[model samples]
Target chain A: MKHACKRVSQLTSDSFERELSLTEKMQLKLHFAMCSLCRNYHQRLATMAGIFEQMREHDLNQDIQLPIEDKQRIQSVLEKEK
Target chain B: MVDKQMNPKLWLKEHGDYLFRYALSRLHDTELASDMVQETLLAAWRGHERFKGDSTLRTWLVGIMKHKIIDHIRKEIRHRDISDRLEHDPTSTYFSENGSWQDSPSAWRDNPEALWDNQEFRQVLQECLSHLPEKQRNVFEMRELTGDDSETICNAYDITPTHLHVLMHRARLALQTCLHKHWFGGHTKS
Candidate 1:
């Protein structure tokens, strides 16, 4: 019975990831305390978030260069609209 | 022409990178994407009066770009894969899998705030975003990656706010789940 309940709560990733209200966090925390599976699940979520953050840093350094001609062309087009 | 409410040039200067990147990701052509970016700027300038500053300047620009993307998509030939549907509707996998959290915990168990603060993570996320359906990817990119508001995003995509929310919700959920599998090797650990 307890294991089944854990499975259901894990499925609520949408609700969990969205900006939860304080009340929702408190409720989630309370539930986690009671359910070991939820505790583990929440931990995994943290790990995944950490990995994603690191990847963003790497991408930021990889320059997305807009060539001078492209910039000029874009500028010229916008200038014409004026 | 810069409007009284917004200096079109300045807006372009500040957000052109993101807008261009957004366009490039979808069209997959640098020149065309840049052209779309410029078009979005011009269109925004012409329609500046309609913009009441209800949403951020970035969001407003994205909304214009969204229309341009749709117009572009309609003009071009899209190669639709009949097999793509099988990958999208993953309902069968969900039910058939063993119901066990012991192997796969939730996702991002560490600090939620810390999840997006790293370099490699962003690259993986970018790769993941590329894999999403075009519409869902665009919506996700605008909202999550670019910090655009839900209302403005809906307006840009010509979708109901409910639809916008649903798309965003699904995108994030899929991303979170996929990243978990990648980082965890199919087995989540605290």
Candidate 2:
């Protein structure tokens, strides 16, 4: 049980990077069925991953326009370099 | 019809802000982001004769900026050894000796889709991300946001895959703890 919990935590993180093997997948499913605590942790982790993805998309379209002074500065610097 | 061959000055005026925002998103520093954009513009100016018009000028400029941004990140990572710093963080408290969560995570009050629409939530999230340590933030951003593969990320930072996983795990744990506090009205027992 001790090692099971640790493996569950690791498996939760590993899911993000790569596919889980059959044995690992079976272990996690079996653990989640009985351990509500681990189940909750897994759910929250997945939700956080989802939010991070959405955040990336949202920020890319955000209105964080560059300041005018910086824009002019870059322009002038480029002009000088040219 | 818009001129097919626009001047470098005109290109800056037309696409500079977009390019600046793109660089800023990845670099997370205004001065560095500005330098990347400047460098991109200079590169574009010097290589103007190679502009085949196959892609828009903005696309070409952004392509150049991406390389510059990656180069800058590689250089920055090479200057510091973050392994000890990352390992010594207090995130170990999140788990117990038995490997179970010390304080199990509670379900978020709002679903991800709803939270995405909530401007205040997004602002809090951005603040939380900024609060992460530099190396953790870089690793998290590169993997999650930029969608860089683990191998590329490891090579760029000169860390092994195992180390990368540890950094990423800690990063996610920290973000989860932070968002729980800010968005979910502090942690609730699961």
Best by lDDT: 2
Quote the positional error of residue A18 for candidate 2 in Å: 3.0
Chain A TM-score of each model, in the order shown?
A: 0.55, 0.75
lDDT for B158 (candidate 2): 73
lDDT of 2 by residue, A7-35 (tens): 67767788787788998889889999998
Clashes by residue pair, model 2: none
| Deviating ranges (above 4 Å) for candidate 1 | A1-11, A17-31, A50-62, A79-82, B1-15, B22-29, B47-63, B66-143, B149-182, B185-190
Q: Indicate the residue-level lDDT of A81 in model 1.
A: 84
The DockQ-based CAPRI class assigned to model 1 is acceptable
All candidates: TM-score: 0.57, 0.80
Poorest 10 consecutive residues by lDDT, candidate 2 chain B: B81-90
Count clashing residue pairs per candidate. Answer: 36, 0
lDDT of 1 by residue, B1-190 (tens): 2345477777677888888877775566888888888888888888888887778889999878877876665444243321123235432233324543444444343454554654565566667777887777766666554455666566555567656655654565466566666653454443
Q: How far off is residue A62 in model 2, in Å? A: 3.2
How does candidate 1 fare on TM-score?
0.57
Provide interface RMSD per model, one decimal: 5.2, 2.4
